[model samples]
Target: MSGIIQLDNSDCSYIKANVSNSHNDAVAFEMKFAKDITIAQLKSKLEILTGGSASTMKVELYKGDTFVTALSNNDAKLGFYVNCDGLRLHVIDTFASFGFDSESVEKFELTNDQYEQRGDSVRNFLKQNRLGKYNDEEMQQMEAKRREHAEQMQKRAESCVLGARCQVTVAGNPTRRGTIMYNGPLEGKTGIFIGVQYDEPLGKNNGSVGGKSYFVCPPNYGGFVSPLSVEVGDFPPENFDLDDEL
Candidate 1:
C-alpha cells in the first residue's frame, strides 16, 4: 500500500505527476517504492518518482504527508517528503500535530565486525531457504505467518496513547501525581495497547518502581483492554482478499 500522507497548508499542484486524483484536497496514498530501488540511491529514487531534481528541491517532515511541523525546519530528511510529494517541501518547525506520533529515525551504529558477521549470517540463512522450495499450501501458510509477524512488530513499535493522565498511589499515595505508562498494564488500571504481549508474557515498565499488572480495559478512559490486545508475534493463517468473505 502507498504510504498515506495528509496534506496541511502547502498548495499541492506537483502531486499531479506521481499521484492520481491530485485535485482531491484530501488524504492520499503516495507510493514510496513503485520504481526501481538501488543501493544508496535516495536522490535518483526521489527524482524518478517525483519528476524533479532532488538536489534543488526543498524538504519537510510531514505527518502522513501533511500536518507540517512548526519546528524541525533545518532537517534534511524533509527533502524526502518534498521529493515524494512532488512539490517544494515546506519545513515544519513546531510540535507535530496533537494526535500524531512524531516521525522518528533510529540509526544503529555497528562495528565492522558486527556488520560483516551479521551480513554473512543473513546470507547463509537465505541460501538455506532458497526459492521455489515449498509446496503451494505450505507457501501460503508461511506467507500468512510472515505477514502476521510483521503486523505484530509494527504494532509493538506504535503506542496508541503515549501518555495517559491517570492518578495512582499503590495504596500509599506516592509523592508524585499524574501518570504515563510506556510499556504495560498498570496495577488496578488497564492500558490501551499501542501493541500487545502474549499469554502470560511479562512486561518491563519503562517507569521507575514499576509493579502493576492489569487484566483489561473496559472501553473507558480507565477501562482494561483485552488480554489478546497485547500479544507476541505469532504465525497465523493468512487471510488474503479471497478469504475476506469468510
Candidate 2:
C-alpha cells in the first residue's frame, strides 16, 4: 500500500504556510514559522497579522484543498502536527463574525452641509482665526501680488522675441540652450508661456501641449517654460561628439 511520506521534524527548521481567515475573504498571505514553536506561540504571532485574539483563534491545517486537522492543542509544538511547506492555515476568528473587525464596523460620516455647520470643524476654526479666505486684507494683498506677477511675466514674454537664441534657467534644472519659437499665453491658460526648441533631445514634447500646436520641432527637442525662465542672449549650440573621452 502507498501512503504520503512525512519528513522528520529535525529535517526542516521551519515550514512555509499560507494563512487566510474568514474575517477577510479577499486577503491571504504566506508566512514561515519555526517547527519548534508551540501552537499558542504561532497564534500569538498571527494576532499581529490577522487582528484575531490568540486565545480564541482556531487554526486549521490543510494540504491543498484537503482538510487535515485543527491545531486544538495549544501547548503542542507546531512540528507535532502533520504539516509541511506549502500547506494552508485557515484561521477562524469567531469574534470577527460578530463585527469585531474594524472593517466590519459601521462608520458615522457627516455631509458637507452638516460638517460646515459644526463649530469644532476646520472651516470654523479658519474662519474664527481670520485665516485664508476669511481675511479680507490678506485676500486684497494676494490679488495685488497676482497682478504684479502677471505684469512681470508680460514684460518677460515681450522680451522673448520669436526665432531668437535664448537659454532657459529654471531652479533645480540644468541650463538649456534653445531658440525661442513661440511666446504668448497658451490657449485656455492665464499666464504667458515661452516655447523653445532645444539644441538636443532635452525637452518633453514636440512643440505641442494639450492637443494645441504652439510651434513645430523634432520629437523630444521642444518644451514650454515660464516667460521669466527664458533669457534672450547670444547662447550658441553646444557640439556633442560621441567619440569625446570622459
What are the Cα lDDT values of the candidates? 0.32, 0.74
48-144 in candidate 1: lDDT tens per residue? Answer: 5444444543333343334333212333232223322332223112322355554564544655567447745433343345422123454465456
**Candidate 2: which stretches are off by over 4 Å?**
1-125, 240-246
Q: Which consecutive 10 residues in model 2 have the weakest lDDT in total?
A: 1-10
lDDT of 1: 0.32
Q: Candidate 1: where are CA atoms >4 Å away?
A: 1-29, 34-40, 68-246
Q: Cα deviation in Å at residue 96, candidate 1?
A: 32
Q: What is residue 5's positional error in candidate 2, in angstroms?
A: 71
Q: How many residue pairs clash in each candidate at the backbone level? A: 25, 0
Question: Cα lDDT for residue 45, model 1?
Answer: 51
lDDT of 2 by residue, 133-176 (tens): 56678657645654665577778789999999999976446889
